[model samples]
Target: MLKKVLIANRGEIACRIVRTGHRLGVATVAVYSDADRDALHVRLAGEAVHIGPSPAVESYLRSDRIIDAALRSGADAIHPGYGFLSENPDFAGAVAAAGLRFIGPPATAIRAMGLKDAAKALMEKAGVPVVPGYHGADQDPDFLLGEAGRIGFPVLVKARAGGGGKGMRRVETAAAFKEALASARREALAAFGDASCLIEKYIAHPRHIEIQVFGDDHGNVVHLFERDCSAQRRHQKVIEEAPAPGMPEAMRLAMGEAAVKAAQAIGYSGAGTIEFIADASEGLKADRFWFMEMNTRLQVEHPVTEAITGVDLVEWQLRVASGEPLPKRQEELSIDGWAFEARLYAEDAERGFLPATGMLAHLDLPDDLARVDSGVRAGDRISPYYDPMIAKIITHGPDRTAALSRLSDALAQVRAAGVTTNAAFLRRLTIQPDFAEGRPDTGLIDRHLTELTMVHAAPPEVAALAALSFSGTLAARKTNDPWALLSGFRLWSGASDFILLEHRGQPLPVSFLSKGEGNYRVLLEGRDVDLRISSSPDAFRVEVDGRTSTLHEVHDGKATTVFRDGESWHFTLADPLAGEDEAAAAGDRIVAPIPGLVKLLHVAPGAAVSRGEALAVMEAMKMELALPAPRDGRIAEVLVSQGEQVLEGAVLLTLEVEDG
Candidate 1:
């Protein structure tokens, strides 16, 4: 085995590689950008090296800098963990030429599958069933439009290079093809430096199923079953599972065989995944699936595969890189149980899943029933320069039911504060009736989005708990006054203590007739309720209407975030002395809701735009969001142009409201 290995990546994937290296007694080296200097992966590795600035182009994507760091740190092998330079053929060849082992496939294989158009052609030659698409070299917009017409309406325009839904779009009609193609090409160019694209027939009910394939230098390759990643949003996977819920043995065997063939055809080695889009409008069958593309490195969802197959994929990568044969043949590999993985991201699901950035003042996760693969600590900052993935929570059980149940429980117990997260949304998705029954497709999230993103404000019991917590603060403020020694003390009956709090931006007034000893008859919205409160350093126990419940609380002076039953509620104390201001009148101004780089501006000054028309496109957190016209107006001023970075609430355009 390689003695020392360098991980050329950041975040959880880097930490994951370091873990396997440590278990195998191989010292690990980590490379970090300026933003990740205090990142968790840096602290986990045995050796660390500084590469460049925070921008990925200056640091993580700098192949020369990565090679220099590997050599300086005495790393014998380099493991490009999934992103950055993982699939770059030039980087792989450079590492090999430098007398260092690249813990991935040969550079030739990477080049063969680097472009989707070329990879699809290669797969067809290898007798692997590929999706019906136009993979030619013609780049003329007019020619591409002709190809799209031939393929049929409701087609897909995808970037030939790179993944992660960066440059993929679904064109629903012929009229939208021209604009969609331009958008896709722009995104592709920004993301992969390639403006090439391919057109394919869009699958109406697609289920993303992929087989994990690994090979060794000794001409041995095997498959590790499959993972179902049907639940997605904007082409990004939200949840994934192994041993697909309703997979049959015959189809499973066929997919495994085809994936192995694809790997062996290119003399591929190390861990890779062959992703297929299955037409599940019927059911999963051997003939209903077609090859999409191959991920030339370890996947983010590999943990679920590990949980089911009892295989450490990273260890396999290392073993293969060390010139070893396949550890297990296809016949020997077996699925043990079912597993589920939920990607926990630092994002607000209610805000169109926009990524969030903040200091993690408090972080709590379940450890008993699930495995949390994370790269951020309690004090870590979720930076906008990188992906906002907080962790991957994986659960295993004897069957899908048990695994999903455990996953729901684990999500509920998560207590992450000081930043908005999708934890609550994930919990809701797990327990949704259709999701619990394993009947979901790529459209499941979007179909049930309204209900899934519904925010549940603090209940009366939770509000009482927040009130009690705030009372403690009031008591602390009077520590120097003997006259106000007892903040909760009441001398007469029916003497109400008034307090105000806000939940989900709504003011709530709470009044309680204190009877002393932490007991009170609280009145909220004119309804009287009896309550008892007890607090400890770890948790708060509140008895509401004769029912007792315990909650974990984190207060940052301004707001108190309470977690209960797998969801979090943030409450802020409303000051009675504060005056209410009139609502801002709707104006002819468009401001950015979040900080992002403007990718495109659809209009110039004096251009007339209709309501809900796309005005500009902004890219942030590796995702693209379009800013639309708030009302029908004519553009009067454009503050930010393409490729310019703007902060949150920065006005991008000023418009003159159209007269009636």
Candidate 2:
């Protein structure tokens, strides 16, 4: 066995590798960038080395630095845990040059499947089915336009070097073909440093299925079945499950055999996945699926496959890289149950899943029945420089239905503050009618976006608890006046003290009555509650309906008052007696959404555009978002240009819309 293994990655994946390393009795080494000095993965590993600066190019993507880290740590092998340098074939060669084992496929395998166009050619020769479209090398604009016409309308322009939907466009009309090609190429260049593209028939209502194929040094390869990852947003998977529901065994065997053959064709070793795009228009027939590219490393959703198959892919990777034979034969490998994996993101699902950044005030998850693989604990910061995925929640049971139920229960009880998240959104998706039926396709989320994206309404009991325990600057009045003490409390008679506070955008109030000084029974919601207060320093706790709510705030007489529920809620102790308003500013230029490189700016200044027109496109958080104009307008200013890296909220372009 390899004595020490260096993980060339960050976040949960690095942490995940360390976990298996410990189990296998292999010392794990972790390499981190400056931004990840205090990251969880660094602490989890047996040893850690600082690679370089935060920008991935300076650190994680630097093959030399990764090799140096492995050498310095005395690790016998390096595991490029997905993304960064996982699929970079040259990096594999560099690692080999350093005389260290790369715990993945040989360099040949990565190179073979590196580019979509090249891979399609190879797969076709290997007798694997490929999508019908243009995968030629002609990049001339006129040639691409001709190809689009040849392929017919409703074709997909995909980056020859792209994945995660970063550099892909589905052009539904001939008129939009040229624009889509330019946009796709720009993102392709920005994301993969390759502007080459391919055109394919866009299979409507497709199911994104990928097979988990594993191989050992002995030329033995077997597949662990398929994962239905059709539930996506912008070509990025949000939820994935194993043994795709309603999947025909004949199709499974065919796809599995193809995946194994594809791996063996390139002399593949270790854990890799072969992704296939299947046309589900007719409900998952055997003949409709075609090769969609391959992820040449352990996948993010590997745990779901592991849960159902009772196999540890990481252990297999380590075992294979250590010159071990196949752990199990093809006949021995079989699925036992169903599993589901939900990607927990630190994003506002309601706000178009906008990546959110903040301190994770509290992070606690349920037991392992709902296995959570997370990189950060409470008080960790969600950085803007990396993927916004906070954790992966995996569940397994006898069937898909039970697995989904466990996922729902696990999500609801996870309490988090300081940033908005998709926890509620995920919880809602679990109960969705279509989702419960296990018939998820790539467009499932988009079709039910409005319902799935709704923000959850706070429960009345939680609201009651929040209102009763109020805080803030207790008003500027009664600094020296005795009546100031009466502000939050009522007198001896049956009366009420109204307190106003703001939570989200709504105003809420709580009423209470005073029984005595420093110690009194306050009338709360038709019931008298015991309130103990220290006159010198005011502090109290209110227990109601079997729940305890803590109150923390300064009694500032009367002015601005702040209170805490799950988060802080502030109120004006004194009524403003008047309201405030501001003039509406024009909403222009679909903002850059997030910090990333500008892929394409579709409209120039002074150009006329229509409502819902594609104005620009940006690549961020490893996905591409096309910014569309909300109304007909004349392009006023394109604040950015292609290939420019920008910050979040920086204007990409502006438009002059006529206000009626």
Indicate which candidate wins on lDDT.
Answer: 1
TM-scores of all candidate predictions against the true structure: 0.90, 0.81
lDDT per residue for candidate 2 within 1-660, as digits (tens), equals 999999999999999999999998999998888878999999999989998987787888889988988988899999999888998899999999899999899899899998999999988888888999989888898898888888888999999986878789999998898898999888789877999989999998899999999988888999999999998888888889998988999899999989988888888898999999999878887888999898899999999999988998999999999999978999998988899988888887777887777567656555555888988887888766678788898989899888888888777655555555677777777888988888889999889999988654433333333343443212312155776655554345643455654444455555554444433344334555654433223323545455655544432232222223322232333333425421123355577666777878887889998889888877666556788887777888887779798877787777784566
Model 1: number of clashes?
Answer: 1
What is candidate 2's local distance difference test score? 0.78
Q: Residues 222-251, candidate 1, lDDT per residue (tens digit)?
A: 999999999998878999999897788899
Segments in model 2 whose C-alpha atoms lie over 4 Å from true places: 140-152, 457-461, 472-489, 494-500, 503-620, 623-660
Error of 1 at 47 (Å): 1.8
The TM-score that candidate 2 achieves is 0.81
lDDT of 1 at 592: 82
